[model samples]
Target chain A: MKTVIINYGAGNIKSIQFAFKRLGVDAQLSKDPEAIEAADKVIFPGVGEASSAMHMLKQSGLDRLIPKLTQPVLGICLGMQLMCNHSDEGQTNGLGIFDVEVKRFSKAVKVPQMGWNTIHNLKSNLFHNINDAEFMYLVHSYYAEICQETIATSHYESEYSTALKSDNFYGVQFHPEKSSLAGERLLKNFLNL
Target chain B: MLTKRIIPCLDIKNGRTVKGVNFVNLRDAGDPVELAKQYARLGADELVFLDISATLEGRKTMHDMVLKVAEQVNIPFTVGGGISSIKDVDDLLHCGADKVSINSSAIKRPELINELADKFGSQCVVVAIDAKQIDNEWMVHLAGGTIPTKHYLFDWAKEVESRGAGEILFTSMNNDGTKSGFANEALAKLAETVNIPIIASGGAGTIQHFIDTFKIGKADAALAASVFHFGEIDIIDLKKELKKQHIEIRL
Candidate 1:
């Protein structure tokens, strides 16, 4: 499969590419719309401030092209948060791929819920062989509230969408690339799908 | 639920692991990448590579080591030591390092924290503070706790957080090699003082120490070197104990 990880000068895309390489797939990093459109699987990744990342997306015009793609797209971390309707981080609007709004965790808990967390309530084939309450590494300050598009839930202060699915589009707040064996399995499932 | 993290820190010099790591069935124990892979397989939540290389050439080799580790290992790892500028962090991240921990450099110029946080986002920026208690005051130290600085531990932590640091890796010099236990009193104070995650480093000799750090210190993560390197504690066994204690570990 021709896998292309959209690189728009956001956060670290090399780790994602390396994860695919470890899985025996040489995923290409491309900002070229044509190369991305031609790929069988497209991986959308982002790390950093929402408004700036969105601004970079607009600069490269991937912002307009990503939501319209038909192939199975996986958005990770801030990439997943940017797929929603809007984010409270920097007061930026998302691509509206997932019907949810992103909000920051309250002071009752840590602002950025870092380290490993369990994802349960699996509802999509993206999870496939993954068991419920499996550990996945997550590092984020903002999160999307549980909604219809939420395929998996994790509790920090309360339940929030850890993974979301809208038809062919899949978004996970956890870094499957950095999530060890189970994360690798999820990526393999995505490739199979 | 977000489980506590167990990190195994590897001290690197010229891209080679400095301390002797006794991992059975490993061909080369000095190779950081090999050791990192072993740690990931052994269920270490995260890995920290503290590059202690002094020469420019040694620093250059760290990049290659990072690339190799990122290529072979799937778990998240952070590269630290001698990282002073945005270019240094950029090169490491491009080499596939999940995060870059800044120590003396961030202390030297506090603006470096804000600059990094603004450029790379706070998630990728980790500020490592090495401090020791002096006359009932936790004073931040430099050069691996040799040179004392005027900044207090809690004040420095709060400063870094206000400057947009994502996490703080606090190592108590007094408790580091002693391995009696983590400085839970200071750690708990730091956790309450900052809104971001706190990584308690040093003084981890047993499984119970890990438990105390998490429960008493209220640390989001605990980091150790000798205990893990010398085979004094097995990560799986320790995590199992933590799980049994209802501490929310990823066993």
Candidate 2:
């Protein structure tokens, strides 16, 4: 399956691109609407603050185009946060597809959770080959709390949605691209979808 | 879990990697960009390029070289030498460098670390402290291990972290190029004193040296040069060796 990775300048797209390439899948990078619409699968990978990311997406009209997509689209990290209704990062509004709000983790812990954190309560197709409470790489301070769309969960100071799924739309708070074999397996399962 | 990193140090003199058994031969190893690409492909968790040649001519090429190597490889890389200001850090980051290391500049202006940490966040700035066993004390050295500073390493490491450096890269000049294994005592002290990650640099010869650095030295990472450049230990094989020893690796 051809997977199109949205390259909107804020994401760590290279690693994700490389991950797909390593899996022998032709993951194309595109900012064009037709290319994205034509793809069988899509992955939205992002890093940086919500406000700036929203600005860039709106500039390219991707903010609207993404929600209309019917094919499977995986939003990673900031990509996942951006798909929600709003985010605490930069006090910004998101695409509102998931009807959830992203809030900042309490200051009781560190800002960026920069190491291996486990994903419990596996409840999505994304966790097919992965085991419950599987360790995945995490690198964000803001998180999406458990909502109607929540599928898997992790916690820093309190429980948060580590993975969310709604129809063909899926979002992962952790980077499957950099998470090694588990990450590779997730991407492979994505291709099979 | 995120694995402990294994890095290969490439001392660049003019966009080329310089290698020496005891920092004396100074012969060319190859192109820095090619070596960096090879290392990344061969399972090097990270790469360190120290600009040994700070000549006016070489100085300008450093940033271009950084961009060149960063473009070819998709891995966390750090560039050091002649970094003095936040603007320098900005330039390197714009060139796609993941981290910037400060040497003499940090000692000359300790606040530069704070300035960089404040601007780009602590994750990008790495404080490279080159120290030596001087009179039974670990004294920080500067100008590529030529000059000395009053900053005792153990205390200075605490100070650097407070200023917002993402990590501390401690190199023992006396053991550098000596291949006598890393300064275990120095590394252990720095690791114990600092809460952040500590990259052990200098005095790496064999695969065992890398192991000992993480095991006995308690280093978060190990940086070596000749042993890596000369193919004494291939990076992938080295990581396999490290993994066998129960050390975490990306593989």
Candidate 3:
């Protein structure tokens, strides 16, 4: 399988690569458009500020190329926020893969909703072998508001979309790479799909 | 709501896990990678690997060990001990560590914390404080809890958060390895003082100790080594007990 992890220099891509390697799949980390385009699957992962990540993506022209990716593409954490129409973080606009806007959690609650939380109301094949009430690791301050494209929802002071799927583009707000067995199953489901 | 976290700390020296792990189902007893995978299977919220190796060659060995563990484990793992600069953090993160914990170096030059937070986001930075209670005041210790500093524990914790630290791992040297319990009073004080989450480390002996750390200490997480390393405490059973006690744990 030719899987390419879009590296725009925003967050740690090495862990994601290692996760794939353990699955008996050798995934490639590439910024070259040709490698990304020719891949059977593309994983868009990020872990930094939305505005800066967007700037880096634009600089590398991945911002323009990402939304055009026809293969199955999965965005994680900041990658998920960037797949939205816009984000409250630095007031940045993102790829319109999902028609949703990212908003910061209320100051009334903890800003960075760290630790494990369960995802339910599953609506995608990405959760094939995963059961409901399974916990996943999450660390983010901003979250995408619930939308029609939402495939899974979680709660942290309020209901929000934890996973979203719009056509070939899929995004998960939590770090499946850091989430244990169920997370591995979810990634395998994505790959199989 | 986000649940309380349970983290098993492993001491790695010269590329191998020290103090032979005695978990019930551990495949390879002294292998960090095998232990990591077993911990993830047992539903440990996270893992912290403390590199006790001091020499340059040992550091290289530690890096190779981290790469091996990362290749096998799929959960968040943190690397700490002897991390001195941006390059060290860069190398570890590049080797697939999810986060890097800064200790003595962060105290020697406080600006190192800011530099790391700037280079990698604060979420990737964890500031570990080793403190020894002195004269009714918890004084911060440097150089692996040997040299004492003038900074107070609560005050430095607040400063670490303000300076862009993602979280604080507070280890009470007096309470560490005692196996009686965690210093809940000091942990509560630090938790109240900092807006960021506080990970309470040291002196965890029983499952009830973990309970007290979360409820009384108000710690976001609890870290222990010996009890977990020696098979005295089972993480899954501990989580089940925490859940029964309404401590809000991931089961």
| CAPRI-style quality class for the chain A–B interface of candidate 1 | high
Instruction: Arrange candidates by lDDT, descending.
Output: 1, 3, 2
Q: Which pairs clash inside model 2?
A: none
Task: List each model's interface RMSD.
Answer: 0.6, 4.7, 1.3
Worst 10 residues of 2 chain A by lDDT: A107-116
Q: What CAPRI-style quality would you assign to candidate 2?
A: incorrect
State which candidate has the highest DockQ.
1
C-alpha lDDT of candidate 1 relative to the true structure: 0.92
lDDT of 1 by residue, B136-187 (tens): 9999998878899999999999999999999999999888877799999999
lDDT of 1 at A108: 97
Candidate 1 per-residue lDDT over residues A1-193, each given as its tens digit: 8999999998899999999999999999999999999999999999999999999999889889999999999999999999999999999999999999999989999978898999999998899999999999999999999999999999999999999999889999999999999999999999999
Q: Please give the C-alpha DockQ score of model 2.
A: 0.18
By descending DockQ, how would the candidates be arranged?
1, 3, 2
DockQ of 3: 0.67
lDDT of 2 by residue, A156-179 (tens): 788899999888999999878756
Output the lDDT of residue B124, model 2.
Answer: 64
Q: What's the DockQ for every one of the candidates?
A: 0.89, 0.18, 0.67
